[model samples]
Structures are given as C-alpha cells and as structure tokens.
Target: MIDNSLGEQYLRIYDELNFDNQASRRVGFCTLENYYATVMEHVGTEVLNTGIDIFGENLAEQWTVTKQILETVDREPPSEFEGILQEVKKHRGNLYHNFREDIPQRRLDAIRDVAEEWRAWLIDCAREYWDTFGAYTLEDFDYIANEINDYSQAYMGDIALKLPTIKRELDYAFRTIAKQRHRRLHYLETPDIFLYDLMPNKTSSEISKISTTYGKIGMMASKIKKGEEIDTDEGEDLMYDARNILISICEQEDPFGRTFNNLHSSE
Candidate 1:
C-alpha cells in the first residue's frame, strides 16, 4: 500500500481547495504545490539511492526527479507523464511567484485536474518499484509490532475494563433468542463505544462519564510511556478527581457563553 501520509496530504489538499473563501483556496494551492515538490523529491531520492546501491553510478543533477530518472535510471516513466509534469510545473511556478492576491477559480480548477494526473503517475511509479523489489525487511515488521503493542494496551485496557458487563448481557440475550429460533444469529446492531464528546452544553451519561475518565487515564499512561511529565502529586487519583469536578460543574446548568467568557477572563 502507498503510505497513509501521502493519502493524508492529498485529503488535506482536497479539503482546503473546497473551502468557500479565496484565502483558503490560495492556501490549498500552496499546499498542493509543496506536496507535489516533496513527492517528486522523494521519488528522485529513491531512484538515486537504488541506482547507487545496484549499479554504483552517479546521476547528473536535473531540475526535477522526472528528468533525473530519465537520464539516470534504466527504467522510463510513461511518455505522457512528461507532459503532465510540465503542466504541474507551470501551475507550481505561477502559484509560487505570482504576486496577484486573487487567483482565478477556473485556473485553480485547471491546476487541480493536472495535479490529479501528476499524483496518479507518481503513485504508479512508486507501486511499480515496490512490486519489483519488496518494500521492507523482517526487522521492520518486528519494530512495527513492538510499537503497536506499546500503544494498544492503553486502548484495549479501557475497553476490557468498562464493557464486560454490557457485553455479557448482550451475549446472553442473543443466545436466548437464537435458542428460540433454533439457529445461531448475531446481534442486530454492532457494538461501538465512543470515548469522549466535545460538544458544549452536552451532559454525559453514566457510561460517558466512565469513558471520559478512561480516556484521561489512557492519556496519562501514554505520556508516561513517552517519558513525559505528569502531575505526580495526585498520582493515579487525578482522573477521578477531575471527573468529579467536571460532574459538579455540569450539574450547575450554567450558561455556556458566560462560563466560557469567565474562564478565559480569569486566565
């Protein structure tokens, strides 16, 4: 699979471009330009490193990775990709150097279309390389597994501690219904648990309170694992005390705007 980072960057570019304001559109264009440069640089660096490793040859410098690869590497990108690269360069240059405050929406849309082509070609090139040569070593798997184990405990522990009673009751109910029907059947709805709600003026139920406390505890544990400092005087009791204070405040039924203004004013 292509790295999630690349997908995330693409999503950011898409989201910013869709904003209703010109400033946001400009920012989207800037982000798209930077990401385009970064991916090209990464592809060039990979080709250069691989060439040095396999063929022990130095490649000449070029304005872009696409050009460098054509000159140095044995492989060639699709003929049409070069044309798309030129289109990408034109947009990148205009966005970078043009002093005009407002870029036409139609021009931005044109660049976006070209950018999609550029990105698709780059991803295909990357995928071809990875398919030709495997992407990782056994050591890499060990490292990834160890990292997952370290963080997963904080999450899985929260679920295990809070959901056993509910899960057991649901299981019993489902089994009873299955026995009546003389066939094994799954629950009608999948179980999903949320840890926190961020909206203002929303009061938490009992389970929500527990989930919030668990979220804090998990956060503290993560910080400790990362060797960051936490409030030591309260020890492990900090989450409980914080939850109680939040509950007390919520019970007051105070106006959210006044409460927010007062809190910030005091700060």
Candidate 2:
C-alpha cells in the first residue's frame, strides 16, 4: 500500500505515466504498421530496405527518425531502464496484434513489478533533484514537470530504437505459425472435430475451429527452422486467419464437454 499524500502525488505521476503508456503503445503499433506499409509501398523501397520500410528507406533512416521523435520525451532512471522499456514495448506489440485477448496474469504481474521499480526510481530522482535545487517555491513544480517529460521522451526513444527489430521478429513469428497451421489441417483425422467444451452460449463448431487454429500455429512454428519462406503476403494472410480463430475461441467458454456430447450423440 502507498501513503495517502504520497499516493496523491503518485496519482499525478500516475496520470503522466498513463499518458506515456498510451503514447508508447501507439508509437509501437505505428512503428509495426509503418514497417509493413513501407514494405508494400514500393518495390524499390522494399528491396532497398529488405522488406521493411516503416522507419525510412532503410533501418538507418528509421533509427534516425525514431531518435528525433524520442528526443522530444523525458529521461528515465539509470538502472535496467532500457530492459523495462523493451518489455513494455513487447506487451504493446502483443496487444496491437491481438495476439492475446488478455495479457496473461503472469505478464500483468511482471508489469506491476516494473511499475514498482519505476515508481521507486522516480521518487529518488525527484528527491535528489529537489535537494539540489532547494524547492524554494511552488513554481519549482515546473522544473520537476520538465524533468518528467524529458525522462519520458528519452525512455520512449530507447524503445523506438528497438521497434524495427521487434516488428520484424513478430511478423516472422506470425507467418511461420500460419504456414504450420496450413500444413497441419491436412494430416488431422478429424480436422474439424471440437477439442473442448463450449460455454452455455457458445457453439461447438467455433470451439473446434479454435482448437484447429491453435494446432496449426504450433505446427507452423515447428517448421520455421527449415529455411521456409515465412514473411510473404501469403504467410501473413494465413496468420491473420489463424488469429481470427484464436480470438473467437477466447471470446467464448471452453468446448471440451460439449464436443464430447456431440460426438457421443452422433454415434
């Protein structure tokens, strides 16, 4: 628990954090989209950038732009700040891609862990800054505000630097998963069979599709190391389809018992 007065102060900081969080999420998604959009924009740009164009004509250009944008934000604490920023960016990417309907509770717990670290760091920074400057008046808040802004900007810049690489990896992973699903559907004895129980309001067919989709993604990932082409438009399309199935599954209850009941009824 946090002290009331401190919590109030923290609330102000929290608001700023929320603002930064939303901004970070937006930046990450924009970066990912830009990466793909750049690739599809023109053949020359695509070839020059090795199929990534979101940052600029190439990775170098993208890095430069990201630096400029991040320079407008604030600074962060010295210890492992970069790692925290990367984790945040990863979560942002996961959310953006709809890879998971809800971040695993464990991941959320990890986020809280980082948030605590950030809070402690910020408090220390504030205390040190105030001690050196001697908070002579209420006007001193402006200085602190500027410090916060600078820290946020710097932290975001660091994250921006890694965005391109992250995007590429995610795209590759998605495509690979898609290809595996495409191949797996052919080998299943009953590819359309339900693998779980649907909730009271859910349909068994939807559950089966979800199960099939999960298996497909697993299959695709296994084959990714075989020097397969997993970054093409076709691959992306397959991933998109698989993701749709997964999302549908998550939206409803499990279909295990319902599937069994139907199977027995058919017999």
Candidate 3:
C-alpha cells in the first residue's frame, strides 16, 4: 500500500490555502511543498517495498529506492529507470524549493506523467522479479532476471502505448453491457451475430492482429448494443471477412491428425 500521511498533510495545506484566500499565497507555496514531499515519500516507499536485492559495499549508502529496485532486478541498474527516477526527483525539487510566484501547469503535468511512468515501471519490475527467481540460485537468478527485466520493459512499453485504446475499449464494453440489459428487457431476445470473430488457435502474429481488430469491434458492439445507431458499413464488411477467414482456418485438419487418429483407434 501507499503511505497517505504526507498526502493528508498536502490536503490540509491546500484546504488552509483555500480558506485564507489572498492572504495565503505563501500557504499555497507551502501546500505545493507538502504535496511534492508526499509524492516523493510515496515513490520512495514503493521502491523499497519492491524487494530488490541491493548488494555491494555501497549498500549502506543512502541510495534512492528506485535505484535499489533496479539494482535488485538486474544487479546492474538500468539507465532508463535511473533517468525516470531522476526526472521525478527533479520535479519534486522544483515543486518544493522553487519559489516562483506562479507554478506552471506544464511542470505539474510533467510531474504527473513521470509519476505514472514510475508506477508502471515499478509494477512491471515486481512481476518480473517474482516470476523469474521465486526459487533460483545466484547463477540461475542472474540469467533469468536479466531476461525477465528485458521482457518486462518491452511489455510495459507496449502496454503504455495501448493504454488509451484499452480504456476506450473497456468503457465501450461497460456501455454495451448496459445497453444489452435494456434490449433484453424490451425485445426479450439476444443478438445472434458475434461482433468480433477471433480464432484463439491461430499463430501469435495473427492472434495479435485479431486482438487489435476485435478491440475496435468490441467498442463498436457497445454502441450497437446501446441502440445508438452506429454507421458500421466498414465494420460490417471487416467482421464478415474475418468470420469467413476463421471458418476456413477451423475447418482444416489438425497437423497431428494421423498420429492422434491411430492412438485413438488403438485405445
């Protein structure tokens, strides 16, 4: 869990600033300082809790939690992770120590973005660490840890790119469910057509393309289910084409057919 004590402090400062109005410009500054402090504390705590192995003579040195986390995962810290942590720290410093009359919205936005990236990285690192060396030795651990870190980094990067689309797709799904409920109550019949035709048995590349295609289909389905008429002239054609492809693929005999047939016959 996240430590909320500092957040509470920042909230209290904000409340004070709001109450005093003109007299509390200084209070607003103070609130900004408190907020930065809180954010730093939260980030620090998260880094520590990830349970990274920090070995070497400098272990006793006051290394940042982010450094520790990366070190634990790869033995050698990643430059990318280090860079993100530095950016977060820089923003925190600016929010705390910089006594400018007006806080730039851009600075705050940058800080928020950095925080989000930090959180995503930490989560990915935790998963990679756990999955790789939940039970392995130093040599085995090193190899697996490196591989898992590389995989996790790539995976996180890809997921980050798709976050906006993922959110849209999920929102569409919820809306579609609500609409479907309404339709069931009124029409008392479910739609027979599948909005997206996907073949789980297909090759990885095909599956990935279908996943992306179907995600859009899912969003479209949500609109259709809601009784909000969507122009699916293009969507309909794609769906029809996809279904035909899936049907053709499914009808093909299994590659291990003869061996399985003989085994079954023997049994």
Query: Which candidate leads the pack in TM-score?
Result: 1
Q: Against the true structure, what is each candidate's TM-score?
A: 0.35, 0.23, 0.28
Off by over 4 Å in 3: 1-63, 75-84, 91-102, 133-267
Which digits, one per residue and each the tens of the lDDT, describe model 3 over residues 1-267? Answer: 333233556555454444333335445544544454444444443333423333321112223654565566684435754554455445445544655544444443443344435444544554454334331223432433343344444432222233333334333432332232221221112211222221224566654554455565556556555655555454544344334333322222211221222323544
Q: What is the Cα-based lDDT of residue 188 in candidate 1?
A: 26
Residue pair clashes in candidate 3: 53-72
**Model 1 stretches astray by more than 4 angstroms:** 1-7, 18-22, 47-63, 70-81, 114-117, 127-267
The local distance difference test score of each candidate is: 0.43, 0.37, 0.40
TM-score of 2: 0.23
Worst 10 residues of 1 by lDDT: 190-199
The digit string of per-residue lDDT tens for model 1 on 129-227 reads: 433342322243233334334434443333323333223322343343233223334322311122112222334565465444444555665566666
Error of 3 at 24 (Å): 9.8
- Candidate 2 structure quality by residue, lDDT tens digits, 23-106: 544443444334323322332121111234543443334433433333333434445644544555565556667743334444
What is residue 42's positional error in candidate 2, in angstroms?
A: 43
Question: Candidate 2 local accuracy as lDDT?
Answer: 0.37
How many clashes would you count in candidate 3? 1
